[model samples]
Target: MKIAVDAMGGDYAPEEVVLGAIEAVKSYSLDVVLVGDTNKIKEVLNRYGAKDNSHLSIVHASQVIDMGEHPAQAIRKKKDASIVVATQLVKDGACDAVVAPGSTGAAVTAALLGLGRIKGIERPCIATPIPSKKGITVLLDSGANANSKPKHLVEGAIMGSHYAKYILGVDKPTVGLLNIGEEASKGNELAQATYPLLEKLKTISFYGNVEGRDIPKGTVDVVVCDGFVGNVILKFGEGMAMFIIRLVKDTIKSSGFIAKLGALAVYPALRTLKKRLDFTEYGGAPLLGVDGSFIICHGSSKAKAIKNAIRVAGELAQQDVVGHIRKSIEEEEVEQYDSEN
Candidate 1:
């Protein structure tokens, strides 16, 4: 499969992005098209002894969407921006998927505008995989749309379920609504309204309401929430993970000589724990409900993160995630229509 990479999207644009593309090409045996300034991308490739690889190629994009720029305006004004060009590749069927470690807004906007939305999808939501004690919990609307309706959350649940099933390999993944309380009567109007809709979905295994504490416990396989709440939870969880890691390291360093000797004994386990908590390990989140597969990585992503993102894009394409989502939504619509009549 051919995947397009936005080499100018993230903080370490061109350098780390190019390196990651090379790693993906070697590891996955897939062709990679790096979109960015041709001269700079080539220089970076040559620096890392990555030139002359038959699997790697470059597509020149004259402009770049800065992290701070307005997403919609940038996409409209900079028609030749790397992010837009990479997404366009997917739209034109030149590539199976597009992977970018750029501004979330820009990536989402470019994908929505370039590829359009799936037929039955109202708005595409970002489905991010969060590491939990039980396994990986998929969180939807993790900053895709700041405000969403009850129907939107229902769609998120449906889409998120398929994502958890296909990408995370969860069979019959249980879905839950992120809310203030576990009771059906809890939460705001939107949550209350969405609760019944989710409960009625035969396509997914609904687990009812789930509180914030349940997220780390992995009480449910999928958590559906509006972008406002989901984004806050995502950011807060990331911060807490970092803080805990730092606290453990500082405590270990300040301990006595005997304690230092004990540290070596547990170092391997600690390293494993760190890897499990690292966001880079999962690569990136997929913007579900879009016409084409688009994996959005962290803006600070390095080579490893970018490589993983490409792998995710490849998996989504091979698995035909978009197709499954369309079928699921259509089934739900049919059921609704029959019941109404």
Candidate 2:
């Protein structure tokens, strides 16, 4: 499978991004098309002794969508931007998927405009995986649509379920709507109206509502909400993880010799904990409900994050996630129509 890499989309573009593509090519043995300024990309490749490799190729893109620029406007005007060209590669079937560690909005907008939404999908949402007690939990609408309707939540649930099941390897993954309380009637009008629709979905195991505290507790496999709330939860969780880790380290350092010894004893465990909390461990978030597979990495992503994002894109494409989502939505629609009639 051929994957297109956005060589000029992240904070460390064309350096870390190129190295990550090289690592992915060597590890996965897949063709990688690096889309960016060809000369700069080549320089990075040569610096890392990766130039003249058969598995790697470069496609020139003249412009770049700066992080500060407006996503929609940049996508429209900068047709040859790295992110736009990478997405177009997928739309034209020149690549199996597009992986970019760029501006999240630009990636999402480019995908929507270049590839379009999947059949029967109202809106595309970002499905991001968070580290949880049981291993990992999939959170959807993570900053994709700041404003969403009841139907949008229902779609997120369906798409998130498939992702949790196929990608996260959860059997019959239980989905929960992120809310103020566990009760069905506790949230806003959107959550209240979405509860029944989710309950009706036979494809997923709907577990009612999940509070913010339940996220780290691994209360469910998939958490569904509008992008506004989901994004807040995601950022808060990441910040909390960092805070706890730093707190532990500071406490150990400032304490007496006994505390230092204690910390030494738990150093291995702490290392494991760090890995669990690292955002790079989960790689990138997948833009679900879109026509083509797109993995949107963090803006500050390094080589490891980019490599894992490419791995994720490859896995989703192999699993035909978009196809499964379309089928699931179609089945639900049919069931709803028949029952109403």
Backbone collisions counted per model: 0, 0
Window of ten residues with lowest summed lDDT in model 2: 332-341
Residues 1-341, model 1: lDDT tens digits: 89999999899998999999999999996889999999999999999888899999999999999999999999999999999999999999999999989799999999999999987788799999999989899999999998788878878999999999999999899999999998999999889988888888889999999999888899999999999999998999899998998888778878988877888887787889888998768979999999999999999999999999999999999999999999998988723422111
Model 1 spans > 4 angstroms off: 334-341
| lDDT over C-alpha atoms for residue 260 of model 2 | 94
| Candidate 1 deviation (Cα RMSD) | 2.6
Q: What are the per-residue Cα lDDT tens digits for candidate 2 across 53-154?
A: 899999999999999999999899998899989989999999999998879999999999998998778779999898888888888899999988888888
Please, what is the TM-score per model?
A: 0.96, 0.96
